[model samples]
Target: MKKMLVFSMLILVLILGACSKKEDASNHGSVNDGEAPSEFGSIDHGVDENKVGFNLTGGTIEEAANVPAEEKDLIIRSFDTYIHAFNNQDLDEYMSTLSEKPKSFNLDEEREYIESVFDEYELSREAKDITIVKFDEETGESQVFANLVTKMKQKSTGLETKRDGRQVTVFSKEGGDWKVNSVYYMEDQK
Candidate 1:
């Protein structure tokens, strides 16, 4: 009888051990176990569907803060408008936000850049957890950062592709308005 009891106890221990291992595997980087990572990885290619072009040369927050309040607001509003335009794929509205003559770069140049980015990264199917990294209200300039979640469509097996881990965007103020200046995409090593 004692031997049978010992055998039963051992069996129970093995079952518990197996269950715990499964639990740990599922718990790996989970919402309940810890802070949920941004879903940018699930998106198609981490492309900002609405992204146009960013000013890659804009400096740090201190420099952006030098912009006047009124100009800053205009810049922020312009950026917001640009985001909307890109998501909606409204070419006319997107163009309107840009400078009339394109002192630094022409509209065509901007469009080509945007197209290249989209073709390359191909931002996720949905956008979420958008956080503004730094916005200097005093300067009216801001660094807007957001996570884009992308996923592979099961139906499109032939078009398999990797996902973008995270995407960062910088906006700058020029000619009393804000425009997307640069987009930095971080890839997952794994």
Candidate 2:
């Protein structure tokens, strides 16, 4: 009787594991029926998953548009500088655009990763539809959204890969200068 019970338990556990795996597989490509969740909540923007870029929907765009023109321009300029620095492989220039105290990752880790990427690959990036998704003058914090396409070629093999995604870069004023605090990216489903 003891042996029979143990075998039955093993079979039940295996069945449950298989069911879980199947469920995960079914949800691999999209989340919440084509809407991706953000820090704010699910964004059901009806963005075509197969498309190469992202689009902002609902009140997010309106909120960004209400920010003062000067503040919005400053944030866009800061983001442009960051992209230019990365494409040029200028480590110092790129680092200058980021906050000394970052919220997403350690500064040292970022530096090391950027150094490695520069050494291993030649990269080019294009940013389009840049917008300020949110801004708070009181806190000196903002979120800049962009649709980005990056192409990277390996130095040794000459193999190239292209990535397209939507990115939200969080910025905060450090000593009166807007610096990048964190970045979140969601790759196109395709």
Name the candidate that leads on TM-score.
2
Q: State in Å the error of residue 105, model 1.
A: 7.8
Q: How many angstroms is residue 14 displaced in model 1 relative to the true structure, after the best TM-score fit?
A: 64
What is candidate 2's lDDT per residue for 82-163, written digit by digit as tens? Answer: 9999999999999999988886556776777688889988999899878786777897888888878989899999999888
Q: lDDT values of the candidates?
A: 0.49, 0.72
Score candidate 2 by TM-score against the native. Answer: 0.69
Worst 10 residues of 1 by lDDT: 37-46
Q: lDDT score of model 2?
A: 0.72
In angstroms, how far off is 81's CA in candidate 2?
0.3
lDDT of 1 at 182: 49
Which residue pairs does candidate 2 place in steric collision?
none
Query: Which segments of candidate 2 are over 4 A away from where they belong?
Result: 1-63
Tens-digit lDDT string for candidate 1 (86-174)? 55545568667655443234467566555544444423344444445555555434555444445443332435464544555555656
